[model samples]
Target: MSGGLAHRWDLSAAAAIALQKSLAGQVERADRLGPGGRRAIRHVAGVDVAFEEGGAITRAAVVVLRRADLVTVESAVARRPTRFPYVPGLLSFCEVPAILAALTALSQRPDLLLCDGQGLAHPRRFGLACHLGLLADLPAIGVAKSRLIGAHAEPGPAKGDWAPLMAPGKTGGRMMRIGAVLRSRAGVKPLYISIGHRVSLRTALAFTLRGTTRYRLPEAIRRADKLSKGGAPG
Candidate 1:
């Protein structure tokens, strides 16, 4: 895939923060998934990263699956030295380099990306998902197992139930709905769903629910997580 946005990954913490704040403005919250709505999403890719050698090395994995059947179509993995320290609200700087390498290795580009991290839910309103989506110029959604920056009420205990995730807005000192807490499986803890780039919250939630099956995570992300952890692909 083409590198949609260009920036040097090696930077100081202050520079990184500044870069994130600048890029956050480029994030388009509107839906750009194209016609046919959900059906337009034919191939969905999941991105994840894992650490090795006491966090000295990063193993990033990208797994693309057919949206209709959730079968793996293409997969790639890349390993690189860990360049950045683990910092809250700055995970993209630590992980995105290796993830971009893995993505560049893919022969089949996906229609949508399901990132294993936050999106607009971050403190700077730019998370790993948003960073990757903007860099790849693809529609992406963040599917996180935990919250990063948002307040929300618990969703219902059943599948398909959801509650709004709110954050303080810049104007009027009001609370803004940044994302949603969605229960992908019945009786399971909800997953945090947020827009990454070029996708709407509703479309992101729908795609996330469609990608999930027996597990609490979406199938593509689950497989990518396993791959990143040194497990063989299913």
Candidate 2:
């Protein structure tokens, strides 16, 4: 649980190349199973992290949603003074610790974990969501607000229009992969859904779309966003 070992596959620098190369192979290797049987999705978890005092203290919150209905089931929060630098692609080093602290405090395990960040769409293909999902050994998806690394057109206003997101790299060649197109209450935003640990790109997109009430952010990420900053569920 220290690093991203959720798929039961521990990723070292040897396995995950730097940004100059493609990292999708490393991810595809770790992914063993696909989406399991469809249930009510009994429990869903959202994780978010915030920084205070110019990123000195990191506060993280985890909110669990009900499968029957998107209601709050369990919640936990933890804070710690961060020591990692604000590296662009190495964000997990700073945020993951705080998130891990919060996850450790959770009372129950969630069936699906949604994160307000990217998944395999990273230079090393190991973004925050992928790292946490792998560490927790749970089903998870990465839903980011802004573009991290990919090329795509604007999705339709109706909903469910998607395109492949290509991770920028040269040596590893093409990094194009599937993502989601969503119409949230706020507006239309393209969500990059990727397999974190136990979930697939398609399944991740479906659950993310289902969790949305009226926002570009998914239910799990939405709740996590507010909770991380100590805000009430909107």
Candidate 3:
């Protein structure tokens, strides 16, 4: 909650999975951003990670942008030795430490976080965005380029159109809505938008759409992606 890495990172794959299940209960599905809602947000940040030296080094990038104009406000990059193996659902264990480090380097924390990974739309309903949101205690959204779980009808081939992403619930065989499949740009692949923490699915969808520009990815995330891959200095 204090922008610190509170949990242990040297966890086994089994332990990490157990931890995710345990922490998933703490994810708040409701909006916590107060009455102002979207207007309350001024700065938004995007987080992403990349591998280097053939996967030995893990690089993380954080780029903060003005929500109104999408101008870069602050950016940071951090690198660490990759300790965890490439586990399918447990990627947070591999990426979060460096992300926290990169976040610490920021001069100011953004009002919202947009992560390039899954959130409630995960197999256990807890993914990188959820993990980072809980640790950072900030409103966050997952803007994944691909689906991690669930199924949905294709979104309309136009910007701002979306469809609900549904998956099996715990009871009654009724499909539970987890996220949204959003078309950020016309005729391009849809993005999976999900609540990370302290945010509603509707708010997440709205913000993701608001943040997107001419590309399939949001502007903040697109810049963060470039930074993570060593495209340019912050």
Q: TM-score per candidate, in order? A: 0.96, 0.80, 0.94
lDDT for each residue of candidate 2 in 1-234, tens digit (9 for 90 to 100): 333443212244343334213433444313333225344467888888888888889999889888668888788889988866666666666677778778888776677778877887776677777777766666668888777776776666655656667654535576556344344434565677666766778777677777887777767677788888888744
* CA displacement after TM-score superposition, residue 140 of candidate 1 (Å): 0.5
Candidate 3's residue-wise lDDT over 1-234, tens digit each? 244537788988889999999999998888877323444888889999999999999999999998889889889999999999778788889998889889889888788889999899998999889999999877889889998889999999989999999999855669999999999989899999999988899989888888887888988899999999998854
After TM-score superposition, what is the CA distance of residue 200 in candidate 2 from its true location, in Å? Answer: 0.8
Give RMSD (Å) of candidate 2 vs. truth: 4.6
Tens digits of per-residue lDDT for model 1 on 72-134? Answer: 988999999999989999999999999989989998678888999999999889999999999
lDDT score, candidate 1, position 202: 96
Model 3 regions lying over 4 Å from their true place: 1-5, 34-39
Tell me which of candidates 2 and 3 scores higher on TM-score: 3
Top candidate when judged by lDDT against the true structure: 1
- Which of the two candidates, 1 or 2, achieves a greater lDDT against the reference? 1
Query: Weakest 10 consecutive residues, lDDT, candidate 3?
Result: 32-41
Off by over 4 Å in 2: 1-40, 168-172, 184-186, 232-234
Off by over 4 Å in 1: 34-39
**Model 3 error, position 139 (Å):** 0.8
